[model samples]
Target chain A: MAQHSLEVIVENSPGVLARVAGLFSRRAYNIERLSVGPTSNPETSKMEIVVNLEGHALEQVIAQLDKLINVISIKEIVPNAAKAIVHDTQPDYQN
Target chain B: MSQMNGASSLVASLEAAGVDVMFGIPGGAILPAYDPIFSSSIRHILVRHEQGAGHAATGYAQVTGRVGVCIATSGPGATNLVTPLADAAMDSVPVVAITGQVPSVAIGTDAFQEADIRGITMPFAKHNYLVTDPADIPRAIAEAFHIASTGRPGPVLVDIAKDALQKLTEFNYPNSVSLKGYQPKLSADAQSILDAAALIAASSKPVFYVGGGVIKANASRELLELAQLLGAPVVTTLMARGAFPDSHPLHLGMPGMHGTVAAVTALQKADLLITLGARFDDRVTGKLSSFAVNAKVIHADVDPAEIGKNRFVDVPVLGDLKFTIAALIPALKVALAKNRPDLTPWLRQMNSLKAAYPLGYDTPKDGSLSPQYVIERLGKISGPDTIFASGVGQHQMWASQFISYENPRTWLNSGGLGTMGYAVPAAMGAKVGAPDTTVWAIDGDGCFQMTNQELTTCALNNIPIKVAIINNESLGMVRQWQTLFYEGRYSNTSLESKRIPNFPMLAEAMGCVGLSCDRPEDVDATIEKAMSINNQPVVVDFRVNRDAMVWPMVAAGTSNDEIMIARETAPDWDSQEL
Candidate 1:
């Protein structure tokens, strides 16, 4: 299984974290590391989820995550650019 | 603006959403909400159990094409809804579930009748909310219904804290819910539609693999148009029984395990498969690697994830089936104008295969009533317009196989989850949804005992749903597996139904008109008598042969190629040439 990372922006609501975590377990996808924190915007949060899944499984994972109504946007963060993306997080995050 | 408690706001929100009726039992946490419901125009059917309320909501939604609603309290009452919520999620039924939560201050303290229901149902519900603030009641309820009834459609849950319910709040219902990232696509990409049309025009053996989404989108008319234009055969899945008419010349019946031979073989031998709104479920694909080995699939579905989740597709169209099929018809017409492939020989081969292996069963040598015959008779007496609900088991399969459905939503069963005891309550809900039409619950002896108490709910509510129990004195499907795979050990499968609480007596005790038929000749008369009684619920216990089995079955985890026409009989696949 190849390790992949996804940066997901979601409405910062109660149970949003649990909803994301529960989806992984329910669909039997393996999660390696998950880091969640409040975004610059108080209405939404950012979640950097790392999973141990192959290319096809990663696509399915992305599609499933996209179905969550609270989820705003998702992008695949390359390993090399992860630091730059994380450091450059600003308050202007838009929905 | 009127000020009221959050509980009253919840009722007002549901009423504004146009919910005519709901199902549930009142409890401490949810009791405040019941006060408004009692005086409101929206009718609330007090179910015997929370599970029944959930499944009934699903049934109502399935038949009426509207969002069904159910309510329950904290702890066990909320948790009991897990099964039906899962069932609705699996079947893509539109249902909104409301639960009362513990007081916000005492939530983590594990106060009396407290459970984190919002967290528990998160895995399956389309979306969920935990509202601790009384002011958020209207918004949460509005979003819950919007999420439940739109997109691909599934159950949604909204849990309000007890203190929030009691707190006075100003109510303002939202004109429209606006979820930032939840947009359901209604139309497919134009290029994908053209590509699918080209395939349909060029392919010799093309099969329309229809799923429940067609019915969900109300696109059966468009499907018929496309199929007739191409002169190709159509095969509906178990969840899609009524999406395509059974009597249509181009229809090949249900496909998958226990599917008709023609339907199964057409999929296996097809050059192109037009898969509409169906996920390639394991029961249908049976050893996925070997299924439809030669077919290039064009999968169109409302859920983007379902397109390539199981099968590789030559063309993937992400849109509602209603629009996808409508778009395809015109594109296919244009493609056919260029070069239409003759499908006569392919259609001939399928017809012959259908005739060679038509669905039939043998009479029991012991003179016991045949389950298949009884179901066939039941379907004939009830007619095509009648709505049929079934519990999981041999009887469920028989009901789907024998019944003729011409209209969408006529057949309602727990196809994906295969939950037992779904028939009675679901049928009750169907009756409530479509009061003018007849609704029948075709259940098994084992399945009946699971939720038969719902008969009391139906009788008291004046729902008047009819039930026919195909009693084989054992779990027939499990016994069939044991008979074939486990050396006939029997192994606790028997219910000893012969000596148990007599079914007719049990029905009468529950305030229903009960009848029993042990012999073959009495089946029709018993059904007719049950049909005649519209004043209250009716139950007819049908004593059938215990050893009967569902044939044309592909055993668990096997390939469709290994399907058996009967015990030890496989089809001569080589003889058929297309």
Candidate 2:
């Protein structure tokens, strides 16, 4: 089991974050790092979440989160994909 | 349809959503919306408290299979709605709660009766909305209903600012919702169905573990067909009392906590457990470590998260309960035709266990009243059609254990939330939803106090739901726990006789016909009289012995094998092993 990261896009509606957070906490999954902000599209927001979980659990979490009414799309950050996102954001982190 | 203010638009939107009725109380901020309520086709039943409104909506939804609606004003009114919303969330009841906020300008200024209801109900509700613009009202209303009724049904909230309600806007309710992220998968794939079917066919002993989802999906027929095909015993959970008819040959009754010995034992011995629409709740599973340890669990539910939330399953089929069960039938039939395991020995063992550990409670010789006797007698008198609602505590457990339900959604109780005072309002809502059904609220004295004011609402609204409060004079369930674990030092659990309100008198004060019976003989006659009243609400106070406890309990966190018949007595099934 290793830490994984994903970028999620969702409608900027009230309680959307709570729905995702509540789902994770209900199953006792802890988010190691989480961040959400407005995306290029004003109507939708982007959320980045990092959690320590195995393949099956991560798949389940992503699938469940994707099913929320406000969620638009979710993309798991593969190693190559992670490097690109990191380079674009220019956050203080190195792979 | 026409240009109208936000309040008018809200009413029209509700009518379009097929909302015939709503349970709520209007106040300062919500008063604007009430202005147009009279113009709309929707009927409003004024409730005493917001919590009562929410639970009444839950009861209505549970019976009607529709999205239940509730309305409340700002601040405390919205705050009061929090409990029932949480209750609905946990139980997966479809409820849509609308609360009025202070004017948009004063929203964050802590203006009179203003509360961030969106933030407050966020964690508990499946979805919530804070409508700031008048034009968004119609869209918000449509989305709220869509999200509330779809997938795993749950509570949704829409907090409308007062100013927005007064703003003029063009009214046109949306025909469809566009949610990119939300898609409820309603059928299991072929591979999982075949796998589960093979397991069922291979098992010498199989148990069908059904829960409230079957009731929600209205899939009791499908569940029964599958159970029969597998020739398995069925263990219905508290929330799924009537999902499989209690009198059916396969029914083993409710399992866990205060569950029957046969039901628990059958599950313990099962080689395969096919769970439908139920989470492995601690109350049902007892000690999580050993629960259904010998069984290969196949959990089928609409909620993907629930598949492995508590107990890991060999097969996790994510889909709507009805669709999933229907799909399993043909596959199970095919598997059975190829090879059917001999279940004769398993059936023999189960029958003996049931006969030996049949649900039995003694009606005292010098006889004060037995709560179990009251429940069983009520069941016999009322017939199978009666809608039984219960508040939390010992009386609730007694009702679950003694009363037999023959149809889905007939038995209603706060299983997951364990909220007290749920019965009165819920019964009223159930009666409203299913007008022909005889509705009864079986409550405990301590629980009766929490929201009994709703009884007054029922009387005023002309909803004639009968209530039978088991007046045990103390918080019996807590007292039972205190007795078992705390050396019987009663503490504050006892309700002082002199200080406690006379329940019958209280019912009378609320404009209900009130009666009292402490004698076992009086139960039959008094209950007959209570059932005969068709024109008005009735309350029967059965002042039962405070010392009486709900038996056959697996003490909290204890394994099923450690189930107790009474305070210190191991159940017969377990005693055999010892």
lDDT of each: 0.90, 0.86
What interface RMSD does each of the candidate structures achieve?
15.7, 14.1
The CA lDDT at B383 in model 2 is: 88
Give the TM-score of chain A, superposed on the true chain A, for all candidates in the order listed: 0.79, 0.79
Clash counts for the predictions, in order: 0, 0
lDDT (tens digit, per residue) of candidate 1 on B1-578: 69999999999999999999999988999888989999999999999999999999999999999999999998899999999999999999999999999889998998999998888888888988889999999999888888888879999999999899999999999999999979889899999999999988889999999999999999999989888988899999999999989999998999988999999999999999999988888888888778898999999999998878877778999998999999999999999999989888999999999988888899999888999999999999999999999999999988888888888999999999899989998998999999999999999999999889989999998999999999999999999999999999999999988679699999999999989998998888888999899998999999899989998898888888899989899988788775
Docking class of 1: acceptable
**Model 2 segments more than 4 A misplaced:** A14-29, A37-42, A54-64, A78-95, B497-499, B572-578
lDDT for residue B457 in candidate 2, whole number 0-100 = 94
**RMSD (Cα, Å) of model 2:** 5.3
Candidate 2: CAPRI quality band:
incorrect
Q: Evaluate model 2: give its TM-score.
A: 0.94
Q: Which 10 residues in a row give candidate 2 chain B its minimum summed lDDT?
A: B569-578
After TM-score superposition, the amount by which residue B339's alpha carbon in candidate 1 deviates from its true location, in angstroms, is 1.2
In model 1, pairs of residues that clash are none
Listed per candidate, the RMSD to the true structure in angstroms reads 5.2, 5.3
* DockQ for candidate 1, C-alpha atoms: 0.24
* Candidate 1 lDDT, A22-59, residue by residue in tens: 88988888789999998889999999999876455777
